[model samples]
Target: MTTANLHAPLGAVSVLRLVDGIMNFKTNLVEWNESRQTRKALSQLSAAQLEDIGVTRADIDKL
Candidate 1:
């Protein structure tokens, strides 16, 4: 095969790898941000509210 034809599949593979990396990064970021927000909101709750949900102050601080 010609050099040009050989490089075509390699370039396509590289592009696919890059797209996969971007998608994985985005999924991880979204999950991280959601967990951070949940922790922050839980931290803002009163001790009684937390206890009602079975969470302690120590648990909130740990998050």
Candidate 2:
């Protein structure tokens, strides 16, 4: 990126890059939250329930 000069103004390119970065960040954050929630729900299941799905308690963290 070029340095912002006193005589030069920012262009639409810089604005678009910033907006794209913000959107990517927001999407990653949402995915992380959903994954945590799914892990929590899986942890709440009983051994039998987990077995029915072929998952063991020790496998929760690996997921």
Candidate 3:
């Protein structure tokens, strides 16, 4: 095979890897943001309010 043929496949594989990395990063970021929002919402609840939902401030960190 010629040098051009080998380089073409390598270039395509690198592009695919770059795209996959970007997609994985985006998915992780979205999940992290959602978890952060949930934690924030739970932390703002009063003790009674938390108990009504059967959750405690200490347990909130585990979620």
Candidate 4:
């Protein structure tokens, strides 16, 4: 009976770890998508436009 009780908590912990992993994956995907969109928008800006926003042409590729 004691061993059965221990197993139940361990099983719950395993499920929690799986849920955490899924959430981390989702967070990373969203960050990557936002970064890509930012780069795309930056690329569309001319040197003057970029400078107007305080971003240099050299900075665009770096971002």
Highest-TM-score candidate: 4
What is the TM-score of each predicted model, taking all chains together? 0.73, 0.73, 0.74, 0.77
Relative to the true structure, candidate 1 has a C-alpha RMSD (angstroms) of 4.6
Model 4: C-alpha RMSD to truth?
Answer: 3.8
Can you tell me which runs of candidate 1 are displaced by over 4 Å?
1-8, 61-63
Better of 3 and 4 by TM-score: 4
* Residue 19 CA displacement from its true place in model 1, Å: 0.5
Please write out the lDDT profile of model 1 over residues 31-63, one tens digit for every residue.
Answer: 988889989999889999999999997887666
What TM-score does model 1 achieve against the real structure? 0.73
TM-score of 3: 0.74
1-63 in candidate 2: lDDT tens per residue? 887666535676788889999999999999989888988999999999999999998889876
* Tens digit of per-residue lDDT, candidate 4, span 25-51: 999999988988998999898988988
Candidates 1 and 3 compared by lDDT, better number:
3
